[model samples]
Target: MNKKRRLALAIGAGVAPLLVVTMPVSSASAHGYISSPPSRQAQCAAGTVECGPIKWEPQSVEGPKGLTSCSGGNSQFADLDDDSKGWKVTPVGSSTSFNWRLTARHATSTWQYFVGGNKIAEFNDNGATPGSTVTHQVNFGGLSGKQKVLAVWNIADTANAFYACVDVNIGG
Candidate 1:
């Protein structure tokens, strides 16, 4: 090839690959954590449910709405996790339900969620109001009849004082 043509080809080959590699692609979920705790009067505190301030990991903030924080109490929410503390399941013919609670003295204080290690939900609580026990429900109608699904609550707004339970319903 001509001298000019050969030089142009060599430079193009090296530069083209670098440009492509540097370009960013869209991902399913963004890497983020709680920037700041949810609004004090927002859903973070449901009907008299006093969850208290969540415990942000300082790293798990930029996640989603409910997440952004982790629970910092010592109840059921403290025992369940994605790796070891598996979820407690209640099966039903048409559907199912699960229930657990958090005391008031655990780890970080905030609210977050994970289904089988994958984040699926989150929440924040001030634990100031008084109400009935917290009840969370999950629908399994989308999965097959026999599937092992785990649910995790990543508390993120209080100290060490809270608990939680997961209820699943399938077929119904």
Candidate 2:
């Protein structure tokens, strides 16, 4: 009953699945790097939302745990795909009903949501006109117990500058 086993058990018994994967907080600069790979399993507790493991160059590096923000823009919980691009698959739980939300800044942007590499939904944001935040919500359909939910935000092709990304795994 080491740490990992204990964590797995705790998560299984909890209301929502736990994020068991953890990544290094700091690392050297690299081009087109992934802040938090999909392996870092994290839980989305009720009333608690966790941002993504962001990856970007040095200057725009500003966020929780030294997660860098892509310069010139920012997007949070924008799901990513298998290619490590801004589109990935996410699993869901047997709960069957949930709301997936995303937040982004800097002009108009697109937020893409997917489950197991399939394009399931999309969100749009037209930057704030009066210093307001842009938030998008979509229904979590066809999700089952112990499923994965991958949410991605496509800030801009020219520059990465993303805010955050997260996957909420529900059920025991």
- Among the numbered candidates, top lDDT falls to 2
TM-score of 2: 0.35
Per-residue lDDT of 77 in model 2: 30
Q: What is the TM-score of each candidate against the true structure?
A: 0.30, 0.35
Could you give candidate 1's per-residue lDDT for residues 78-141 as a string of tens digits?
3222222232333445333333222222233334444444544444554333222344344443
- Give the Å shift of residue 113 in candidate 1: 4.7
Where is model 1 poorest over a 10-residue stretch in terms of lDDT?
34-43
Q: Report the C-alpha lDDT of model 2 over 1-172, residue by residue, as the tens digit.
A: 8999999788787734323221221222211112222321122111122325432121132222222222212343332222343233345443333222222223435555555556566666544221222334545566544434444444443344332334445443
Among these predictions, the greatest TM-score belongs to 2
Instruction: Report backbone clashes per prediction.
Output: 74, 32
lDDT of 2 at 31: 17
Those runs of model 1 whose alpha carbons end farther than 4 Å from true positions after fitting are: 1-89, 93-97, 105-113, 120-132, 157-172
